[model samples]
Target: MIVSGVILLALVAVGGYGLLSGTDSEMAPVHRDPAPSSTASPRPETPSRPQVPRILPTSNPETFARRVAAALFTWDTGAGLMPLDYTSAILDVGDPSGTEQAGLAADIATYLPSREAWVQLRQYATTQYLTIDNIAVPDAWSEAVAQAQPGQLPPGAIAYTIDGVRHRDGIWNDVPQVLTAPVAFTVFLACPPDGDPCYLLRLSQLGSPLR
Candidate 1:
């Protein structure tokens, strides 16, 4: 498991933050009035569900890291999508060897809204995306790399810590509401020196990325 392997690196904390903070508080209860279909004008059609954006193949570590970060944050509740729908997008770009897939799935579950929360948030037509402030390889990661024994790490493995703000928007009682919060996390991946594309390995706990 990737969690066990990452423990050897001593790279990150054990678990992620609690559920996306303030999601429920920011959302208002569903309104209970009914507009008669005959008296009410036709409601605008909901937009078609978007295609899940998968992480693109890339040999550049920073480029791949940024894509992973964005995939982790960008989501919509009103698009006829669920949290698992978003999860699948990231898993599509996960470690192809399947070694870390289970750990990766658990890590991802922490960063997204829960299924029950998803159903509630849908009432508000909520959406979210990240605005990255910075991305870099942390000093601790370099030290860990130097300390690693031969065969301890994968060929071309690297880590990038991302700092950003998570911005969420939703309609509440006929008014649009927006919330912004700072976020940080690390992405572990490998781009083999032999010209293969990068593949996601694991994610550090949310709010506890390596320095």
Candidate 2:
């Protein structure tokens, strides 16, 4: 994990606040009238389900970060995974909550190629692999902590480099090629003091021409 307990404690000591101090709201209950008929109606035909890609589990924050990076870099149009599906997979791996996940979903949809575009490029079906180079606390996180008021701690963030490549079908293409040079990415994560798993708060490519 990028944010170890000792570092988190040091950060809190400097900021004069704990990481998990936010309040949570209770959901309101909904009431509905009893059904008019106890008997069930005829069932409708079930629609075919979309083929969603598998999501791997991560044991810690660093593993989760790597998984998120890999998910963002890899896609397969021929496997019936669309842009939305890809983003959904990332959301699953990150395990974010509230409107944050919705915002990320929208951002990813806008950033990646559209379904139609992917279909058009199906002939060159490519699979991308991402290798994590390093993970460290980003300067932005430190700056935010320094500027935060008492009783407020900055959100945790980790910066990591990824080397990516696109492998095309050998028969369709002469040889596989690197998509672009190694790129760095910064991912913001919510670190609760209660020892719960950290969730991704935001993601951005750092000076990477690809995507």
Clashes of 1: 0
Assess candidate 2 and give its lDDT: 0.48
lDDT of 1 by residue, 80-183 (tens): 66789989999998888898888788889888888988877777777899999999998888876776666666889899999999988877776788888899
Clash count per candidate: 0, 0
> How many Å off is the CA of 89 in candidate 2?
1.4
Candidate lDDT scores, in order, read 0.78, 0.48
Model 1: how far is 152 from its true place, Å?
Answer: 2.6
lDDT of 2 by residue, 44-133 (tens): 454445566554653366666666666666655456456777777667745344535654565455445666555555545544445566
Cα RMSD for candidates in order: 6.5, 14.5
